[model samples]
Target: MFKCFYPDQYLDSTYQINFEQLYAKGFRGILFDIDNTLVPHGAPADERAKALFARLKELGFGYCFVSNNKKDRVEPFCEETGGCCVYKAGKPSPKGYQKAMELLGTERKNTLFIGDQLFTDIYGAKKAGLFCILVKPIHPKEEIQIVLKRYLEKIVLFFYQKQKKEGNS
Candidate 1:
């Protein structure tokens, strides 16, 4: 079964998430993956991303980016987006996620993780005992390795949808 890889919630875009509601629910920390999860891969943090982080801050939530991308990419993005980051994060392993939570001074029960990848982001966050939200990739032009993984993701997602439709999720 693909249950372990299944996200706590699957949504169309990270922009569509109701962070206010999440804050009201006592989720004070948010962990994020950069790249397609925010802007397109290799793109810098834009005004939209900056605004969103500002809004999250106003809502009294702390955020940290957990990215597999090297420090060169993650550091500037994190700085521009108004949050901290753990670069070269080995995702699909809970250590990075746990470290991000520590940086934010958050507990597992009050943290959420959002990203575009299932195998890395969702699985790692789940292992770290954080709520995971899987968002559709922002752009389709990904690296060959990710493109290959998307094919497998589709099969797991098919079953995930079926389970959700049957109200078992």
Candidate 2:
């Protein structure tokens, strides 16, 4: 019933994903959410993010940040991380994800997305016909709306876990 919101993969952290394996599997591009996915919400890109981007470049992958934030916030972080971005992305809408795929020059078949939220991030990727990875939020503190969503996410996740245990994934 709620299958549309289920992620292709769910993990504890974005940093734990194996980009090399994805590359080996013929995935050439990645789209990312900026906030709690990579850092605490609103915090600037840190050294770890920069290093991850560096490793991605070393692996010959094309990548970009698909963020809902305005240019003021997304630009400097992309600049610091040596990555590109599509700001004000209006996620869960196909246009922004399409724009990002265009920016990376990747087709949906070869592109992947990693993010921290189900409603915005995972749903956006799924709607765009891209593989999606859902990572747990990096921090406990979040805006009230997100906290509210987390409660609902738990219900979906419970079903997701049950499905996984059944080998449906």
Candidate 3:
């Protein structure tokens, strides 16, 4: 079952994922995890973040933030990004992911869920029948559960990286 619990796809870093690159792959919508995926946990957006969101909008790709965090934690960021936010989402559950798709008015086939956790972000997106993009956490201390998850992640990522390299070869 452990092998059954692995992510569908992986990325070296969230920053390296350009909307244009993904657009070429036929992904038109993006659902982002708030903490770690966009910014460090409990951290606010910097100037670069504002610019990034602007570019995402310019690309005409639908994007939204789906976070398991409370409204207090998610609202401000959504406002800052000018994107919709689904709070108290309970990731790995597909509820938030579904809501995001509704907000974007798109189907799962055109969507990409990007986040730092395999269990929540990746699994939930997979369950929702959307493509998943696994990104490294910006900060380990953002959530207590992340500390343990990160440990497990190290092992999973090793094999993931090897497979990716082999695929390229």
TM-scores for the candidates: 0.99, 0.98, 0.89
Tens-digit lDDT track of model 1 for 130-159: 899999999999999999999999999999
All-Cα superposition RMSD per candidate: 0.5, 0.8, 2.2
Local accuracy by lDDT, each model: 0.94, 0.93, 0.81
Candidate ranking (TM-score, best to worst)? 1, 2, 3
The residue pairs found clashing in candidate 3 are: none
lDDT over C-alpha atoms for residue 148 of model 1? 96
Off by over 4 Å in 1: none
Relative to the true structure, candidate 1 reaches a TM of 0.99
lDDT of 3 by residue, 16-121 (tens): 8777988888887899997888788888876767888888888888888999899988889988878888998888898899999999997888988889888788
Question: lDDT, candidate 1, residue 151?
Answer: 96
Q: Which candidate wins on lDDT?
A: 1
Spell out the clash pairs found in candidate 2.
none
Which runs in model 2 stand beyond 4 Å of their true positions?
A: none
